[model samples]
Target: DQQVKQNSPSLSVQEGRISILNCDYTNSMFDYFLWYKKYPAEGPTFLISISSIKDKNEDGRFTVFLNKSAKHLSLHIVPSQPGDSAVYFCAARLKAAGNKLTFGGGTRVLVKP
Candidate 1:
């Protein structure tokens, strides 16, 4: 079974609106949670992340929330833009695992103008 999962295969939002993407995990040993954005034929770029010890982390319009009790997390994009349209992925790693990340099936975000 996959350790990380993104139940939503896709999400659509209008420009300037908020796009919320959800993720679930089975491993409690994870030390870090991360979100990445990628365009077609391009490598995924890190967007935002949160330590397992923290509940939330935000950078500009992107925010990541973690709930250890539920083994769940979510990524929120406020004021979504067309430039933000891409495939978003949720990934996690155990500090002891030495930077090996378990990635969830990505969620495709369509930010329509």
Candidate 2:
């Protein structure tokens, strides 16, 4: 069963604007949330992550917020750039699963110049 879901298939944002990507999970056992960015033909690279214990985490232009009670999380990218155009995947890891991740269908983000 697909435990994680990204409702939006894509998002478009103007350069220098904020882009927000959302995800939801059916599994409450997941204890970690991560966002990965992928360029065409390239492997996804980690962008940012948040632990279950924290409500929010920020790093540079990327920030992740977790709402455990709602079983949802979001990634926000501020001042989006052209190079930020890519597909973003939302992933969740169960505490007892040990590195095994459940991923949602990616959301394609396009930052227009």
Candidate 3:
């Protein structure tokens, strides 16, 4: 059962533009949402995260928004740069699951300069 899904398999954006990534989950038990950025041959790195209690969280050029009712979340990258190009994965965690994470099919983002 794929509880989390990324409807779009890829996204392309020009440098200095905003890139929006979407994700949806079917599990209401999720208590946290996280986004990770992965480069070729590298492990996914934690990018940003949001708690179920909050609707939005921003850090520098990255921001994450969560909609509990819709079980949807999004990550926005402002002024995307060429170096920002990577595969982004959306993940959800159930507090009771204890470190277990459910990940969506990654969305590959390409920032064209």
Candidate 4:
């Protein structure tokens, strides 16, 4: 079973537009959520995170919202730019699990100028 899932394999958005990526988890024990952006062969970079105690977290152009009650979450990028083109992975970790993460397959985002 997919503990974490990003249903859409890819998404394309016009530069300066809004991009929304969705994610879902099946485990109720997951309490910490994170979104990582990866470019090509490099490792993923932490973009934003939201703890189970909170519903929303934002950083500049990126925002992450968590709905623990529904086992779902999403990442929103306002004014999406070419620099935002990459693979976004939604990850989760249980606080009692020592922070080891379970990552989704990933969703690739492309920004058209």
Q: Residue by residue across 87-106, what tens digits does model 3's lDDT show? A: 99999998897878999999
Clashes of each: 0, 0, 0, 0
Candidate 4 regions exceeding 4 Å error are none
How does residue 104 of candidate 4 score in lDDT?
Answer: 99
TM-score for each prediction? 0.97, 0.97, 0.98, 0.97
Runs of candidate 3 exceeding 4 Å displacement? none
Better of 3 and 4 by lDDT: 3
- In model 1, the Cα lDDT at residue 77 comes to 92
Q: Write the per-residue lDDT of candidate 4 for residues 1-113, one digit (tens) a residue.
A: 88999999999999999999999999998989999999998989999999999999999999999998899999999989999999999999977877789999999999999
Task: TM-score for candidate 1, please give it.
Answer: 0.97
lDDT of 2: 0.96
Candidate 4 lDDT for residue 35? 97
Please name the candidate that would achieve the greatest TM-score relative to the true structure: 3
* Candidate 2 least-lDDT 10 residues: 94-103
Which residue pairs does candidate 3 place in steric collision?
A: none
Better of 2 and 3 by lDDT: 3
| Stretches > 4 Å off in candidate 2 | none
Model 3, position 32: C-alpha lDDT score: 93
lDDT of each: 0.95, 0.96, 0.97, 0.95
